[model samples]
Target: MTKRNKLVFAICAVIIGIIAGMVFVFFNQEDLINEDEAKAIVTERYGGSVEAVEEGADDDIYIVNVEGDTGTHKITINRHDSSVEAIETIAKPSEDTAADDSNTSQEQNEGTENDEPSEPEKTEDESDTAPSKKEEPAESNEPEILTVEQAENAAANEVGGNNVYSTWSGEGQNREYYILQIVDGDDEGALVSLNGVTGQVNKVVYLDVSDDDYGNIEQLIYEANTYADMVDGRYIEFDDEYFDEEEDDDYEDDED
Candidate 1:
């Protein structure tokens, strides 16, 4: 073969190889995400540091462990689409009972230390001149109030919800109530208020699913829970009774 023809044939072979390489990459490239990306996604959604990320049973799925504000949870993500598939709570944060006790003790100690300096021993004439005062009768002790857990249970029982997103205790102008943001397995969410002392459900305001243009119930729950955080100011109050007759029926059944 002529030298020029040989060179041209070699050039054509190289071009074919380059085209085959490009086609292989286009077909075989999967949009698989990495561990760092999984961590970022989880942190953004859950607001916590990602502890670890591991491969799931399937190559396209990743399980990310996160220590979030609410609890330690494992978030499952689809690596291909970078979508969160499931979030399972491993454990909820425990109440800092020790810290509360310490604070109470500190306050008591401060009160004791801050007692007013004893007035110089009053002279006999001064003591005699002090206006005679009658001691007021001692006040009676109040009844024990319901605990947070009991309040949550009462609210959940009334609403048929299983998951509690947040809870707050406050005294409004009219009454003292425990407010809870709860959601059922079906993504139905509601804000519930109940009497703190009596454990009676006072009101329930369900999330407006009809107007959920975003179609993300979990996000909706997060937004709805912010209402409970506004304890210092006014909140949604309801005077109408909520599921009281049903509670009465349950009590009757228990007695039977």
Candidate 2:
């Protein structure tokens, strides 16, 4: 063969090899994830609508796009096994006006107090409960117990509420004893930990309530359904409820 012809053939071979490599990478990538799992994972992580953007081959990966308040996320998954390979996020304007609504709700809640005398008295009663040792778990490693006054102050700072009832105490996995309870009607109280020797509220969760028995699971389900409709799918579950007589009795004993 002529030198020029041979050179041309070699160049063509190199180009073909490169093309083949790319094809292999694109086609032989990995496992396959079904549409349902992809959607569920995306929704849980990003809290939005997840739509399939691209499908993958038998051994290739699928790509999905999740739309959320902040932006859009591109998630790649293995086709054969349905595991996530990569995720890319793109910023976009928020779709839900939750922030604005939350602020308005807070303002309304604050303003309504001025029109009612019973509300202030109720708040005072709730706050006076104070942190009690009975709520502490038997195996707790609480270094120091917080005084009722200190607990009240901590709760107030965390959520602008004067009635911060200290309900339960236990050693959290983080090497701190957590004081847990309900605060405000819609808010979860907090988990305050104190220094070994200081009676102080070390940590606070403005809205952190634990799951209750949700008595008559059927009732809970009905309530959840009603709430879902009321909120128009904006909220899926009811995290708070009116204290049951039994629960109140339990609380009274604990308080004592």
Candidate 3:
């Protein structure tokens, strides 16, 4: 062949090779596990009812929604390997209702008990010419903020985690509190926020370490620290209607 024809032939051979490699990859790529398989894997691992399973942002990932006894969880699964990537807690069972019921019962029991009023007392020197003295005002009653250890304990009580990976204690915009990173094993964990004054749980958010590069423990602790720095120790009830109000208004405007 002539030099020019030989060069063209070489170029065409390289292009064909590239096209063949692409075809092989497109046909032989690893197959992803189905939605039912993903649900079974999550249900077996997390011991919850799999409410729904949806495709994730990536083609090889699945997001499984589960409702456990303690809370609702959003579990991420790697469909190719059938591995759990992350578990995010969307909701925890409310303790306020139970607390209120107990308080009411205690108040009712106390109300049934009768108390006797004390009689007035007179001193022997009441008639004496002693000068009357001004009484000092009562000391101010204030709630005491809990220590770091107490805050950690409070968090542990709310979430049944055997290990506390990390703890951050500081005063936020509204109150003083502690945020703790807790985990059961390598995969499951939570970031717990405890009230410093009341020793009550403020929030319990599940850890999502799917994108963590440093490892689960390190990333979880880092997340706890970041959350502690940003939390203002304020609890606000989340309502879906609140978010849709603007959308509803726009729809009404369109009708008019």
What's model 2's overall lDDT?
Answer: 0.55
Candidate 2 regions exceeding 4 Å error are: 1-31, 56-59, 95-256
> What's the residue-level lDDT of 18 in candidate 2?
99
Model 1 lDDT per residue over 17-134, tens place: 9999998866644468878888888888778888889998867789999985577899999987899999899988667855676789999999998896866888999989999889
lDDT of 2 by residue, 27-123 (tens): 6543345567667766776688875566755536567888766677888876566567897887665635767767889999999987677633446
lDDT of 3 by residue, 1-256 (tens): 8999999999999999999999886764546788888888988887969888899776779999998767789999997788888989998857885677689989887777635455667676864655778899988676566767777677777776654454454554345454544355554556666666777676666654333523555545554545545556443222224325767999999999
Which parts of model 1 have CA positions greater than 4 angstroms off?
1-30, 97-256
* Alpha-carbon shift of residue 114 in model 3 (angstroms): 36
Candidate 3 Cα misplacement greater than 4 A, ranges: 1-28, 94-256
Q: What is the lDDT of residue 232 in candidate 3?
A: 60
Better of 2 and 3 by TM-score: 3
Clashing pairs in 3: none
